[model samples]
Target: MLGLRPPPTAAAEYTLGSPRHPDVRVRVHWPTAQRPTPAETGGLPVLIYFYGGAWTLAGIDWLGWDRLFRERAVDAGVIVIAVDYSHAPEVQFPAQPEQGWTVLEWAHGAARELGGDLDRLAIGGASSGGNLAAAVALMNRDRHQRPIRLQLLEAPALDLTLGHVDAGGVNKAIPDVILRQMAARLVTQYLGTGRGLRRHPYASPMLARSHAGLPPAVVWTAELDPLRGDGEAYVTTLTRAGVPAVGVRMIGQTHTSGGLRSVVPAAEHLHRDVVSTCVPSTHRRWTIRIRCAPRTTGYEPA
Candidate 1:
């Protein structure tokens, strides 16, 4: 369980409704520090973040990660936009993904209005959020010519079809029945009818027709998560497609560990990584060097 933390300094809220479905309501979170100003703070990169909670539970307000996102956005001199989309069982299937694209398109056009550089953009999320981010990146690459500079996926649920089997290589102590039940619930809610679930790239990004021309990516996986293999396979696909990708497996971590911001050391480390990746550099040109902390015996990259 996560402990309460002080909310981050309030940022301005912008209401954006779906153009295709005006009845559907959504909002975007913009960190206060990144507001547009003619004097300074202009031309900063934008990080559009999506939150995770399977396809049903959790919302923009459920986790305190927004505060952390704001802190990192300010510290890294980038504008952060968090989107609140409709969840499943109420809006089911392609609804959330479609809303995600709408938000992305809106953000791209309004980045300057929000004090973000249109040329430098990154998409990121955790768990289910990560899955959406990955889907968005692929969709953007295949459908449009917009530039996506980087992508960061933390414990992404890439392959919803994996069922009870551990797809990411590592396995936890959770019983198969419970895992299967949870997976079934998620799959059913996300795909609505499962009739053509396999054909939709948003439902199963791992089965995409092609992974070519995707932006450079940083894929994070937990050593104990059931979805770990999905993340691993994604990284492999990205690399094999000639895209630059980095895979990191957090030792002694689980599927929902990143959400345990208050109790997990791995969670804290993950936050640091997110900040490092999302923040824009002061120089026009940039170089990222990930220096690992010295490890003791038995600790190593998987």
Candidate 2:
């Protein structure tokens, strides 16, 4: 047992599990209303968000992600289905991605029961979570053709090979070489001994031969993050493939800055951007006027 205190509580939640994927646990967080129902709002959109932990650590119970998911459910007026997929090493490549696919399928199938709109279903993640989200979007396209309305990637580690990373950042306390080494180690841990798997498209979405047909994407990156290159390149490739994609960089912020929404003002923009972006573009619902902050690289859909 983890002799630790339980994490913060959400407004409402329920569990989803399957015998095939016993290790994975899916949690659906509801908005904080006394009697929340879809009748008033027509139906809420759904965001199946995956949290980041380099693909090897952390869970939905992580205080930062727990808080963020709760806020997103209320502000964005969408149901947040936070996935707790199994980590790497203990499991391996394909395992995590497959679990992600399963969760997406489940969410799509249960949308009506969850009081969610099928038209505005989206997949999102941060760092490693971003990688999984991208992979699942690809799977949804290739297999079932699920209507994934949007793909929100924040500081996503798209290229697990670490080829498209920026070595320099605002914080230089750790030398570039050490940072690279640490990142390399994390990649190794996720892939185990199967280093060739790094080149697989699902493992590294940036290396995918084609970025066409994926859902519209809102990619966010921290100016001081090494993963900035991955996020930006993803936007470039997606746009080139005739997909509508937007990339934004948070200036003066590091990789972890996004989790500081409660304390950092700039971080609040992250939440705001997510809330704004989640609004369906082609739907029959309401509209939200988006205004980008000065420090942020503006978000404009192509």
Candidate 3:
């Protein structure tokens, strides 16, 4: 057990098991309501989030993510659970997805105890975390474990095979070659001795046998991002498979733009869109979708 820890106003570091069941750690952010609880929900809608870092602890020591999470919880009036999952290389591919699935299962079973509605569960993540979220959705779909409401994938690293990063365009952010190299090294480390696992659905959801029956997806991609093509393609696949999916490509932004909300307008808009998309509508159903033409093949403009 950890002795000294941060305060729990925005997020409380919660443990799933105390040397009983397999131990799992997470940071859960509970919302603030006017009354004792919201009317529509006897409990709060839970948004399980995974931070971006190629499955690594990127900013665990930093306070930025915690602040944004807290603000989003208050604004959206939902329980925000940010997972501090183990990193790759050390733990490898299957372990990452396996632990994520474990967290989702634990959250669903413990939702009521934590004052979160089991029926209103949503999952979201950024970058590599986004990839894991997508994998979890697909896992749930195949296993029929739980019904997920929405999947918010922000600049997800979907195609782990490494060739998809070379979009053959210049936008002034990280170059295609560097991005490709990074992906190659990361994939090598993640797969370790199991190189063929790259094509596995849990490792790369974009390479899934079918995109049918998965949860509705809200895909956020950056125009300059290397993974933009894969992210948008996943949206197209979902749409064609009859799932109501929307892909938003933020112009003049990079892969990690979702984390720069305070400085960039596009980033801030993405942040607001996430909060609004997860939160209940005051008037009618709220969504970030726009009417796309029949032949449109790319992302919807943001």
Candidate 4:
């Protein structure tokens, strides 16, 4: 349902792997400061990102990722590499995770080529893309790949089984039953016959047997989203496992609403804060101390 649009801003495109089960196409976004070479400032920080589409739709043109590409690069002075993983109905579950893994592995090993510092690599995404980001971190930890310094999950669908949803907190526009039905379709399309079979932790990360050793993360959730339960639950799991994890429940909003900066003030806060947290301030290139300045408890704006 998304149209093919050339990146509306300046970015370098590259093809990674093949077009089969796990091949991917990626774009590397750079801050427009000095146009420094790949290893600027002894290598700039890298943000490995995935776009949200419920493992079925969306690409770089999605409002969230596209906006980040157009505005954040210059302000943040960081490099963002977005992965275009193959969607479902044509591919399947493991394919998406495998593609995510391939991109992570390459990013971890080839940071210098992208004008990035391996030491500051972070991963993030919106919606299903958020799920994939968490899965990639899990895979990285399991595979002993370079540690992911931070993870940013926005309205992530962390649990595919989704038994934790109460639907009491969701918005009227997105009813609980309808959301559940959509989730069922997503899982069915991605897992196929595997629904009756085994559900891998990598596929449904919250279902993972453990959450220890995962990187610190900022889990952003919309108050009215069914996946809010999943993101909140994941934060608890990670925190209990000794990972420094924080959860932000965006009140009076639904899933992916934080990306709508033009309409919502809180959404702008979320979008800007996310981009800021992803990159180091020009003054402090090697140090990062992020503290949440939440507005208020309930729906009060910041």
Worst 10 residues of 2 by lDDT: 1-10
Model 4, residue 78: what's the lDDT?
74
Q: Total backbone clashes of model 4? A: 1
Instruction: Judge candidate 2 against the unseen true structure and give its global Cα lDDT, from 0 to 1.
Output: 0.81
lDDT of 3 by residue, 1-302 (tens): 21122234445676664222235578777765322333434777788887788765574434666766676687678887887766766766677677678889888987887778777788888888889999999999888659688898988988888646646444557566776776778888777756688888898898999988888889988887778888888999899999889988888787765666545656657767777688754432333443322322232457
Candidate 2 lDDT at 153 equals 94
lDDT of 4 by residue, 84-167 (tens): 888887988778877888888888887887678888888888888998999999998898767688898988888788776647
Error of 1 at 250 (Å): 0.3
lDDT-wise, the better of 1 and 4 is: 4
Candidate 2: pairs in clash: none
Evaluated against the true structure, the overall lDDT of model 3 is: 0.74
Encode model 1's per-residue lDDT on 96-197: one tens digit a residue.
777777778888898777666788888888888898888888778877757788888888888777632473334435566687677877778777766578
State each model's CA lDDT, in order. Answer: 0.72, 0.81, 0.74, 0.76
* Native-referenced Cα lDDT, model 4: 0.76
Q: Which candidate is the best by TM-score?
A: 2
For model 3, what is the error of residue 145's alpha carbon versus the real structure, in angstroms, after optimal superposition? Answer: 3.3
| Predicted structure 4, TM vs. truth | 0.86
Off by over 4 Å in 1: 1-7, 22-38, 163-173, 282-288, 292-302
Q: Which candidate has the top score in lDDT? A: 2
Q: What TM-score would each prediction reach against the true structure? A: 0.86, 0.87, 0.83, 0.86
